[model samples]
Target chain A: MSVLTLEDVNSYYGNSHILFDLDLEVEQNEVVALLGRNGAGKTTTLRTITGTVPRREGRIEFRGEDIADDSVDKISNRGVKLVPEERRIFPTLTVTENMQVARDMSSGNPRDIQEMYDVFPVLDELRENRGRNLSGGEQQMLSVARALIQDPDLLLLDEPTEGLAPVIVDDLYDVLSEVVAEDVTVVITEQNVDFALELSERAYIIEKGANAWGGTVDELNEREDLLDEYLSVGGAEAD
Target chain B: MVSLGLVFDQLITGLTIGARLFLIAVGLSLIFGVLDVLNFAHGVLYMIGAYAALWAIGAVSIPFIGLLGIGFWPGLVVAILAAGLVGVLIEAGFIRRVYDREPLDQLLLTFAFVLMLTDVVKTTFGSGSNVVDPPGLLAGSLTLTSSLSLPNYRAFVILMSIVVLAAIFVVLQTTNVGRLVRATSSDRDMAALLGVNVPRLYTVVFFVGAALAGLGGALAVPTQSITPALGNQVIINAFVIAVIGGLGSFAGAFVGAYLVGISIAVGSLIVAGAGQLIPFIAMIVVLLLKPEGLFGGAEA
Candidate 1:
């Protein structure tokens, strides 16, 4: 069953048009990767689904219910949550307090705080520390953990591995791998094509604000020409 | 050299003055901290609070309230409610329209409320200055020593400030709503995306902020001559406090209020008219030293 579907969605940031005729779908409990270079509306697509964009046209369906016009919070209440690119942690709030915000805001039954701590044990150690005091890797973990606490049916991750040391990235991969085992569906937008493909079963390539190509992970890996053309991911030989 | 007794007297006076300023300035700081709207009409809300208290005192004759031994207590409640209601209307009706617009638009919108509300107050309460007598229970002075005594009402005001400060701290520190407020203040978009109702939260904040201003005005009723221009006059001091403490830093506002209060009181002792100039001078010095304010970080 499809958990989320966007048909012919065109989004705008004030006067500048971002997403153009973007069509996408995510099946229930599936990890889908949205791949593109910078400024290709990958983040904007996630934002539009979450109703963060200023203006968006076309249909956005969550669980077969049209939610194209729902407000951002309302969309979130309906079980779609977005972990934005910048990590956007509340600097003044303690790590536990940050998680408490998500728990308090969730209309659905939120995950247990201890469960989140179990997944990201570093968060437990720094639970009393303010978000600003955390390292970059810690902030990202907190951001992702905060979304998970909401117990969202469909989670949107924007550039989850944007900037981090290789060690931190490996840790995040382990955490996400654990999350994928749960009952939630994920739609992730990424510039790191290799990392995204490793986690996602299917991939959709977006270029210049529209869908360029999409297929199973095996099919996408076979098309080196498509990766080089759209994602600027050099063919296997170039590496 | 100033005598210790004289210095003590001036410090008490300064604290009383700072207490009143905190009532007004903290609201301005909270509104800015959360809503990101510098409400110029905050003073108008304070004025409304004073006028509301004055009217409530005259209109209601609750014998039980008088029996409770605090005649003007009900008046304070009225002031907070009236000002809070007006704040809700201002936020929901006017300020909401300008949130997505530029900061100048918000400033102009609030300034327009200042003008409009001031005129409304003038028409209703008249342009004449009004004064409220301190409640009978607190009408006398408390004698400490042969050389040291304090006005009972001023002591009450200081106690009230402390109570308000404690209450706010408890609410912000312990409550879920408080956590949401801190989260929203830090990153509004993220808070909203996390399923927090941002617009409703904005309204709640404005109501609290406006209510605090009204409480300040109502509290000042027994202390100062209430005039049509009272809001305009106090708002300047409130702004100075907010700026000195840093725009959204709560601790900054508290320390800044006391500093301004002490400066004004002590400066008056040193020079005849220096009280009026000291706050500005202090602001300039603080800005020169630490541009963001004492407790102001990048987030605040």
Candidate 2:
């Protein structure tokens, strides 16, 4: 069964229609990437699933249960967790304390902290540092680690490599690859098409809140004209 | 010999007054931090507590010390529960809808509530300033001598406050629920996304915060008069302490209470009725330098 499914979803912010008949699904353990240019509602889709962006209409089913109107907490407790776009780490809390807050909330195993430290060794090195003190790459990693503490089944990552140095991006992607390999379903939204192309099993291109194109990663690579036409990336289709 | 004794006497006096401030300021601070609601009616809750304690004493028709286990303990428990219930009702009927609304709206609503509560209590209890003296067993002065002595009740109030503050500190520092309180206060929306039952936590915090305020008032009954305007004096004074400590900071509130309490106590010793001005002045200075608070960051 798919871990998450958005069936004929429609959402609006005030009078502005932001999402229109959005249909998507993520099978368990698959890495699906939503790639788009700015204002394409890439972030909104993730937020809607997370319930950070309010839902006006649609069925958001998780693990075969209908939880369309449930609050973010309930949805999260059911195992879908979102790592927000800006990496909303608690500025006032230390890295360890941030982990502790998540630990306090859920049935987190004590051993998970060690596993998280292993996932991001840099975080272990800076465990005592305040969230505000971490660099962008470090904060992104910490954000992921924070979500892991919740023991989520489906992890929604928003722009995990937005402003990292090349080496840091490499490190982050390596961590992402390792995580996705371990039976955790990941849906990453990125402006970095190359990473999405290489890492994701399936890809969707959205424009102004609706899916413009979707295909398997190999099929997506074959459609160079599709990329140029929909994603505005130069013709991988023609090439 | 007398002068040295009086200084010791004054130090003891400072602790009693500090307890009263602790009861008032921390209540306001907790509600302000978690609900982001200033609870203008806190003084009214205090007044209710004092009056309720008075009622417990009379209604039970028992000796005062006997009242501690019987009238006093039961009365205190009832007072906290009743006040906490009222806080929940107010939040449910009015506050929940206005969470995303402006603070000014909440301020006006709570202010109106203060007026309603004060008038209601005044009408029911009458405007008379009722006082409950220490029970005879606890009444006699503890000697610094033939001329000077301290009432055992006031000393008890001080000791009880230290115990209460210690308990509050332990709960906030160590408990899981307390951590949830801090999380919600720090970021309500973020807390919700993280799977915290935010609305439920909101109601619970409001109840507990109100209960503390009410308990403070009830505990103060033996020492002060129970009048309609009692909440007014309590709120104004607590606001100063809350500001001095940094709004919503539990630790800051605790220290602020003692500091402001000491300031007022010392002020009254020399300046008489004008000592209250010290808190106002201290509040203004703290506001100027540390707007976020003494320990916390800028208010969200």
Candidate 3:
């Protein structure tokens, strides 16, 4: 059975409609990349899944149970966690405190705090630092580690590599690679096509709030026409 | 020449007043820090607390604890419970509706509550002022020197405020609920996504904040008169203190309260009729120098 399935989902922000009849499915322990251009409703889809959108309709099933009308915290407690695009770390809280929050609130059996530090050794070094004091790379690591400590069944990463340097992106890729190896189900949304393709097995392309195309990573790599039509990779191709 | 003993006496008096102000202002600061709502009804909660304490003292009598006679201790407990209950209702029933509204709308709503609650107090307790005497155990003064003496009640207020401040610090720094509060105050949406029940937390915070105001009012019963307009008068000073300390900073409130208290005490001695103007002047100076207040960085 699929870990998460969204069928004909419709979402709105106030009167402005953002998603229309969006259908998606993720198998257990599968790595899926949601690819889209800016404002193509990629983030909105993640927001809808987490119940953060102001209003949403249609079926969102996790572990075969419908969660369409559940509150954000309820959905999260059921083991669906989103690492938001902005990496909303509590600036006043220390690194350990940030992880402790997720652990305290986690409904599932949480990973021990020491284990999180072991996975992200850099965080162990900066354990005493406040969230605002960390570098971009460190904050991203902490954001992911914080979610991972909750031991979420399905992890959602929204633009995790949005504002990092090449070296930092490489570091995050390694961390996420280890997380995936632990048999954790993952879904990622990214503008970095190379990074997304490298980390995901299958991919879905969304355009104008609707699914544009979906196939295996190899199939997507061969389809240059679809890439040009849906993505801004035309500029990268010229370079 | 102004004697050193006189200055010492004024300092102690200033601390007592600051202690009272801290009880009221810290609640205002906490509510704003977490809910991002300026509760104009906060003062009314304080007023309710004072009235509840007065009523409790008059109505309840226990011989065993009569050492602090006239139900002073019982009144304090009743005052806290009454104020906290009312605060919970205000947040769950009324303030929750305006969470997504504009600041002006929130202000108007709370201001409406202030008017209504004040009237309710007027009808229930009568418009005339009332007073509660200090418990017999705290009815005397402690002579420190030839010209220096501290009223036992004032000393009690000061000691109690210190204990409350310590408790607040420990809870905010060490407890799970405190960590959640800090997390929520910084980013509401993020906290929600992490499984923190934001709405329920708001109610809990409102209760704590309201209880603090009640505690402040109950403590004030021995020092000041209670009236329907008392909340309106104290709330203005509380706002000034919160602003001076920075709107969401607990440490700032602590320091700011004492600063205002000292200014009032010392200013009265140095310049006649100038004590009233000193706090405002200090506020202007602080605002001009640091618009975010003395310790404004992150919420809570």
In terms of DockQ, the best-performing candidate is 3
Tens-digit lDDT string for candidate 2 (A44-158)? 8988887877545889888988878988888777777788888888776778877777777664343377788988999999988987889998999988888887777888999
- Clash list (residue pairs), candidate 2: A224-A236, A224-A237, A225-A237, B43-B231, B67-B72
Better of 1 and 2 by lDDT: 1
Q: Score candidate 1 by DockQ.
A: 0.75
Model 3: residue A24 alpha-carbon error in angstroms: 0.6
Computed on alpha carbons, the lDDT of every model, listed in order, comes to: 0.88, 0.78, 0.90
- Report the interface RMSD that candidate 1 achieves against the true structure, in angstroms: 1.3
Point to the candidate with the largest TM-score: 3
| TM-scores of chain B, in order | 0.92, 0.87, 0.92
Per-residue CA lDDT of candidate 1, range B119-172, in tens? 888876678887778888899888898888888998999898888878888898
Full candidate order by lDDT, most accurate first: 3, 1, 2
Model 2 regions more than 4 Å off: A107-111, A230-239, B1-14, B59-69, B135-138, B145-148, B288-300
Give lDDT tens digits, candidate 3, residues A129-210. 9999999889999999999999999999999999899999998999899998887999999999889899899999999999
How far out, in Å, is residue A178 in model 3?
1.8
Docking class of 3: medium
For model 3, the stretches where C-alpha displacement exceeds 4 angstroms are A234-239, B1-11, B59-70, B270-272
User: How does model 1 fare in lDDT?
Assistant: 0.88
- Tell me the TM-score of model 3: 0.94
lDDT of 2 at A65: 89
Best by lDDT: 3
- Work out the TM-score per prediction: 0.94, 0.90, 0.94
